[model samples]
Target chain A: MRGVVMYTAGDVRVEERDDPKIVEPTDAIVKLTATCICGSDLWPYRGIEPADHQVMGHEYVGVVEEVGSEVKNVKVGDFVVGSFVISDNTCEICQAGFQSKCVHAEFVAQTIGTQAEKARIPHADGTLVATPGQPEPELIPSLLAASDVLGTGWYAAVAADAGPGKTVAVVGDGAVGLMAVLAAKQLGAERIIAMSRHPERQKLARYYGATDIVEERGEEGVAKIKELTGGLGAHSVVEAVGTQESFMQAVGATRGGGHLGYVGVNYDVKIPGIELFFAGIHTLGGPAPVRRFLPDLIQLIWDRKIDPGKVFDLTLPLEQAPEGYKAMDERRATKVILTF
Target chain B: MRGVVMYTAGDVRVEERDDPKIVEPTDAIVKLTATCICGSDLWPYRGIEPADHQVMGHEYVGVVEEVGSEVKNVKVGDFVVGSFVISDNTCEICQAGFQSKCVHAEFVAQTIGTQAEKARIPHADGTLVATPGQPEPELIPSLLAASDVLGTGWYAAVAADAGPGKTVAVVGDGAVGLMAVLAAKQLGAERIIAMSRHPERQKLARYYGATDIVEERGEEGVAKIKELTGGLGAHSVVEAVGTQESFMQAVGATRGGGHLGYVGVNYDVKIPGIELFFAGIHTLGGPAPVRRFLPDLIQLIWDRKIDPGKVFDLTLPLEQAPEGYKAMDERRATKVILTF
Candidate 1:
């Protein structure tokens, strides 16, 4: 099998790797039908995060090729979608809907790179959510997104308490941010504001349910949000970018007693205690517990209630994984889907 | 009128000052019945926070001496307890139960020091909660506690979602922390843990319903909390100290899906983004929106359901407010009350 790997910063390659196989009673071998590069993947590609032959992807929609004896819910020949974080969903944390921090959880990229032709999934029954049926080819990208970005955006919206009567502000123009706009809209936010400088992304954000687009960034962006909301700021804010500027903007754009849900993989960010304290808001952040939402999201996708796959602007063969990485690294694509 | 004033760092004096008079249509002048030195007051006295010729004190229970034309809920001769942050209570933020961040909010200490013969309270109808009747002198200290610490602790418990079946951990052993233990108990937390080093404070914490005590500080303290909660950490944590160590300990001692509520007046603290992001906890902080809880708190105090006044170990005449400040600054008193 050929999979994506990074030898060093900006040194991505598609090379031959050993095929995945079931190694534990709770494991399953998945033949990835689709996978994609993530915004966080750029962290290492830009030298901001260290990488030494690190396997590249975590999101995947696949068909189970083999299942171990203990994997009861999922079996071979099943079309499934799995979260980036594997969890034994029965654990206390997972049962409480924080599967991302599940007691027996592990990151898929750490054990089996999903960008490969085949990958081994641990805690198979709990981590993988089978679609009702084999999804249409065009729906593959959307299903892959449910593995991380879509579910993450959904969690962000839920954490921010986005619903009827809420004015939601999203900071960031990336895939996750756009998805968050969609989630907020789906969650019934009365108004959605997308902070974006790019006309293309701004258009997509509007298409996804953003009622307003603020082209400014940082303090100016926060001021614009306040101006739009009668000087009170938005009732909820989704921070999909993890920089200090983005975090502060999210916090600043939220009204007193509002919620700020941040999902970006934090880089070098520090929250000032005085400002955060005086801000008087609720904040919940971390890796999105995607597994918790997979069932409903998969149903939504299957029923055509949402088309989050539109986030994938570029598509390529798995062998062209390096080019897929390059497109996202250069900001030439919102997301790149790789089909095997 | 005589009021408490900080002439310099650690230098408190009771000096003659102009008597407060109603200045706003929503204002009322209150004759201080009881006032107390807060844990936060020690910040300036210890030189951690700057002090000049600043009027001191923000917590008080008093009798309404005069009312402006628009003061409706509270009137002359009414016994009332007011929050440290005076708010109009009708603003959207206040209506949403965040009076501390109310649009028309004002800090009592900045406008009219509470530790005085009489003080002017703005937004009288909103900031002051009148008792069912003139509270007995024996109830003065407890009513005074309602003005800040007790309300703050209640807010902390509420913010942390302390309720049946939850395990709550309190950081800091100050009056507020001890009060938080009491609040958690009243809020129905199944188990309450107080982290303290002082024997007296620990005893008070136990009396206030702390089911466990962890005397270790910093990482060791967090380790103990994890040990107590089956290595999963507490379900809810109250941070009553504003230092970085206390903040981090609160975050660290919370389970992945737990809640952290911090109400300490932050001095110099910065939350590292990466760790907090990965902590997977819901966090809410700020000055306590005490006004939101005053009605219920006052009712409880009036009904003799709680005795938060026990936290005030030292009582002095208003003329000896300086000594009260000294006692609190030197750690001789958990809280000091000054009576007229």
Candidate 2:
């Protein structure tokens, strides 16, 4: 089987690797139908995080090729969408919607990277949600989006309490941020402000339901959000960028008593306690419990109710995984879907 | 008029000061019936916060002596309980139940120290809640408690989402922490764990409805809470002490997807971003919007439903305000109520 692996920073390759197989009774082998590179992958790729011969990719929509004896819900030939953080949804934390912290959870990239011809999924019944059937070829990207980014963006929107009569401010222009605009709109937010400097991303943001765009960054961006929100700030702020500046901007752009749902994987950031306390913002974020929403999101994709797959501006063959990573890392593509 | 003044750190004096007069159309002058030293007061008193001939004291219950032309809800001769933070409830933030950050909000001590013969209260119609009548002499201590500590404790419990079927862990044993146990019980918390080592405070905690008492601190305290919650931390945690250790303990003692309502006046505390991000806790706290809950708290106090005032273990005359501060500073008393 061919799989994507990073031997070191700035070194990504697609090479022949041993095919994944069911090692546990609760595991299943999925024949990868679609997979994609994530913004988070850039962390290790840029040497910001430690990396040594690590298998890459966590987002995927695939067809189950084999199921262990204990697997009851999913069967071979079933099309499914799974979260980046595979969680045994039976844990108390998972039941409470913190599936990312599930007691029996594993990171896909660390165990069986989804960017391969076949991957082993643990806690098969608890982690994988089967779609209605094999989705249309065009719907593949949308289903794959549900595996991570779209679900994460939805979680950010929900955490921010975006809903009818509320104004939502998104703090990043990446796929997640643009998707958050769509989520906020779907949740009935009256106004969606996307803070993006890039014209290309800004166009996509507007297409995804952003009512306003602030080209400024940092304090200026917060000021624009406040100016648009009657100087009170947006009622809900989705922080899609993990940097301290973006987090602070999201916090600053939210009104007092408003919610800040941050999904940006924070890296080397220190949130000022005093500032956050005085800000009077209700904050809930972290690695999203993507599994909790995967079922609904899959249905939405199958029903063609949402086209989050549009985020994938480039597509490549599975053997071209390195190119996929390069495109996303270099900002040449918002997302790159790799066909197996 | 006479008032308590902190001319310098560790130096408190009862001195002659100008009697407060109506300063705004919505202001009222109140003749203080009672006032007390707060834990937060110790900050400035201990020289942690700046103090220079600053009028002290924010907690108070008093009789309205004069009302401005626009004051409609409060009248002269009416007994009232007011929050430490005065706010006009008509503001959007105030209406959202965060009166502490209201556009017209003013800190009581900064504007007109409540520990005085007469003090002017801004936003009289919104900041002051009138009692049924002149509070009986015996109710003064309790009514004064309602002015700050009790309300703050109640806010902590509410913010932590303490209610039926929930286990609540309190991370501070001060007056507010003890009062928080009472609030949790009244809010229908099934189990209340008071983290206290002081024998006297422990007794008071149990008296106020603490079902369990953990004598440990820090990691041990978190372990004890986890043991009590079947290897999971408490569903709700009340952080009444704003220190790095206490804050971390509160965070550690709360289960994933739990609420942490922190009311401690944070000072020089740096919360690690990674810890908070991975903890999966819902956190909300600040200078509590006590005014939002004052009416109900006052009604409960009036009906003798809960005796939060019992926290005042010592009493002193107005002239002995210095002694009250000393007693609290020395931990010789849980709280000291000064009477005129």
Q: What is the C-alpha lDDT of each candidate?
A: 0.91, 0.89
Candidate 2's TM-score reads 0.98
Per-residue alpha-carbon lDDT of model 2 for B193-224, expressed as tens digits? 99999999999999999999999999999989
Candidate 2 local lDDT, A77-195, one digit each (tens): 99988999988999888998889878887888786788888889999888899999878888989999999999999999998999999999999989999889989988999989999
- Evaluated at residue B218, the lDDT of candidate 1 is 90
Model 1 quality (TM-score): 0.99
Checking candidate 2 for backbone clashes, the offending pairs are none
Over the true interface, candidate 1 deviates by an RMSD, in Å, of 1.3
TM-score of every candidate relative to the true structure: 0.99, 0.98
User: Which has the greatest lDDT?
Assistant: 1
Off by over 4 Å in 2: none
Docking class of 2: medium
Specify the poorest-scoring 10-residue window by lDDT in model 1 chain B: B264-273
Q: What TM-score results for chain B when candidate 1 is compared with the true chain B?
A: 0.98
